[model samples]
Target: MVVPEPGLPAAVTIYEVGPRDGLQNEQGIIPTATKAAFVRRLLAAGLPIVEATSFVHPRWVPQLADAADLMTALRAELGDAAAELPVLVPNERGLDRAVELGLRHVAVFASATDTFAERNLNRTVDSQFEMFAPTVDRALAQGMDVRGYVSMCFGDPWEGAVPIDQVVAVGTRLLDLGVGQLSLGDTIGVATAGHVRALVAAFAAAGIGPERLALHFHDTYGQALTNVHAGLQAGVTTYDASAGGLGGCPYAHSATGNLATEDLVWFLTGLGIEHGVDLTAVAATSRWMAAELGRPSPSAVVRALTPPTE
Candidate 1:
């Protein structure tokens, strides 16, 4: 079943986000030790780039209240590899924490629509960059590469269909602010495959090729995998996925868990695309994490291959 695809890139970089984005929205707090183990398992399974944790204020995401502690544990366990892990830094304060930990890679969250910006960031869409500007500057000053996440690129629950132009506008502003890459987010998962291609095309027209972009999709409406296919055809080589499908927007109630890493690996493997992830190991890890959370994994590949135990 290893069929090679014609148009897709030979290799893709799976930006694993489970440790950070996946656990942030959990109702119960996961221990720092458990979180560190999750990252270690992922790295052992051949995930090239795993996002470690977020530095946002604990008041906002209590589940990741131990961000600093988790990073410390990861450093002790993984050593130099820990610094290669990416962390989400919401603003200057978060970036400061990352700097103190000697972390080198970081990401900042941005919103495409005004409503989501107000709710998630407490600033207007245009003004949100003002908040990110200094943080991006300081991170760059310290020789860190910052990835920008543009949420609600496809559709917003409050604003309905987001215009392609508006999404590009917000994305380019982040690029202007010096983010090395931008991850387009389908936050509520309302996008269709056609919409996904259109948005990617729009960015391409703006001189933002797939080389500078990553796709982040949710499975709220079950369009996540389909959109990934579109991204592949459109030449996107980087994707953001969660393990066990374990993530949703803490701010957007309508949003659901992200596209599962196991599922993405299965898809890539079937197409003969050289994604460096080990699918069997990822599924096993997801099952282990699901056991810790006392739930079944939502990934179709994980569920089909590793049946739930009694």
Candidate 2:
């Protein structure tokens, strides 16, 4: 039932964020070995860029406390390929650890609203950039590719509706600070398809084209896939999704798991778009991981495609 959509990109890059963002807020500490295995499974399933883990402090995200250990295991398991995995480096200390490990790709988290910035980063919206500037500069000097994540792009729990111009301002500052790409986060999944188009248009108007942007949507309100369709129509070719729909904002309790990678694959497959992911394999991997986590996958595609038990 493949149908080609007019004006959509023939190919899209699925930036897999399951390992880091997906597991960051989990209740239990997934063993480093299990985390490594999960990442390996996703890569084997044809995920192009699997974000492996975060270098953020263990206190803030206890689930990924073994970030270094996971990276070490991945390096031993995947060798040179492990260097291509992306990790979140929240500050200079995190960057130092990443540099020490010879990691090549890193991402920084930021918030569009001042309230969220203070809650998440303990800094105001403007000051978060000051903190990220040095980290971005150092990472770039060390030959690392940096991706900036602007959360609360659509709306905020504390601040309610966020202005489009405010989102643009935060995103542009990250770009100005030398981030190679921007991942606009609908952190609480409150965005509609129209909001998606308007935000993309706003970014484009600010001279940041779709080529330099990626959409990261949460499925809290069940609008994730809808927003993705609008992103595609607006010429966005990169998306951030989690396998098995496993992730939520730790700072924002209302935010649910991300748009599932399996669901994204299904939607893209139906549209005859090229993402190079094996839908069956991803579903299988998610099923396995869900068993390990002692929960059912929240992804509709995974639930529909996978057997009741494996």
Candidate 3:
């Protein structure tokens, strides 16, 4: 039997980002039907919270251009489970689209550094707040729970090694805008365990508890799991991960795959943390998704557990 680790939450919430963040970076545009089926499979695998799709303009992210179609199909297929789905909204327009679809939850993204903000959103860091404020306020007023994603919280490809204070400031602004949760992203995966601890400590010092924060790390330098360990040690209970590790930032060219869902589930299981996610089911889903994407599973745990076909 596994033993509970000190300073870790008895249960953790795994925010599955495969259908949205994972497939969004793929070169091929996944069909809306395929994407909807993928979301169903993830829900069947016991993921309570799954990012469904992004409402970004097709010119920017053509892969998820069928966001509306996907949402429609998911609502029809998943029924009440559809309530757990959250879509990404880039602006008020995106939020409007989400509201039209009857979405009750949405996520808005901002970057820690000016370079990333300018490149990713075509706005400066400060301007990003201006862009997001009205959207966040509108969403909250509509009774929609908003989530804030702070990208490049650890390191930016253009601007390396972001300062903790800068990340905290952006996070504070997001929270002030009434976002219920903030997900700190290691976009280029330059975070270490120490960085995770320091960032969480800084946020805590600013009165933002770990309960309101989620950690999203990529495995570019192979430190994603280590950073997750640090986050758990620091009392963070929510984490964002992709099945089969299927994502990279198109804007951040050097970014690798996200922290794999299978890998994180394995770690959580060993730590005696109750995540309510089935590791075997997630591994199977990862393998299936890798086949759909025409790539091998990027998750080490999935590869180890899944037998190869002759």
Candidate 4:
């Protein structure tokens, strides 16, 4: 006796964060120029917001040892791109590198679950937020857009279940610090539909309206799209997805890819929602990326688009 998924707004925005989140976790470090091509292809394919790289120290994330170089190359190639390519900046040093290169947008992250904060960022809750404050101020002062990410909003891999208030308190601080969007991440893909509804409701009651939120769900347990429905029902219109379910949380052991962007678009369109993205082209783009990455794609849309075997 459950209700059908509620209708979404006439239009919704999908921010693609695959390049930064998806590629960073790979054990092999993709070449700098190769990373540039990933950004170029996604931008050419017309993704609205592509998180290009992270400015963490090379020792921390050797995968992005060439963050500055990638930016220089991508920025030059922005000539025909229809989207914004931003980087992830976790603190002052990371943000400083971004500012030095005249970057316009960057994302910062924290965890609703304290265990993740320590495991992921190796800092306590308050210390991590403090690390972000000056970076937020500098980015705002420089007229850059900031997207704040809260990992494990629904449940944590190590911490069992995160309290709703902790999610709200951290999210509010980021929003208060001038983040244009707060992306709630089901980092471990452990959220059920019921869990999704409860957390979104809790966020709403905390005076943090739906407009400022986006859901970033992982598909580890195969219930991500169902959780997306629950998220839509709770009034969140924006979503963060990867082109071919290409991203995962590095800190979450055994956590799998995100809800595929093409799958999300397909789901929304089938339900008569308007997302203004070209699904056919996106599927093609996913195929291209999968080929480049030398891996089989996890996206259902790409699978559907694959030619039938003889």
The per-model lDDT (C-alpha) reads 0.93, 0.95, 0.92, 0.82
**Per-residue accuracy of model 2 over 7-91 as CA lDDT, tens digit each:** 9999999999999989999998889999999999999999999999998888888998899999988999999889999999999
Tell me model 4's lDDT, rounded to 2 decimals.
0.82
Residue-pair clash count for candidate 2? 0
Q: Per-residue lDDT of 176-266 in model 4, one digit per residue for the tens?
A: 8889899999888888999888877777888778888899999999998898888887888888888889878777876789889889888
Candidate 1 C-alpha lDDT tens digits along 11-115: 999999999889899998788889999999999999999998999988888998899999999899889889989999999999999999999999999999999
Candidate 2 stretches with Cα past 4 Å from truth are: 308-310
Candidate 3's residue-wise lDDT over 159-203, tens digit each? 778999999999999999999999999999999999999999999
- TM-score versus the correct structure, for each prediction: 0.98, 0.99, 0.98, 0.93
Error of 1 at 191 (Å): 1.1
Candidate 4 wrongly placed segments (more than 4 Å): 1-6, 80-83
How many clashing pairs in candidate 3? 0
Best first by lDDT, ranked: 2, 1, 3, 4
Q: Give the higher-TM-score candidate: 3 or 4.
A: 3
True-vs-predicted CA distance for residue 30, candidate 3, Å: 1.2
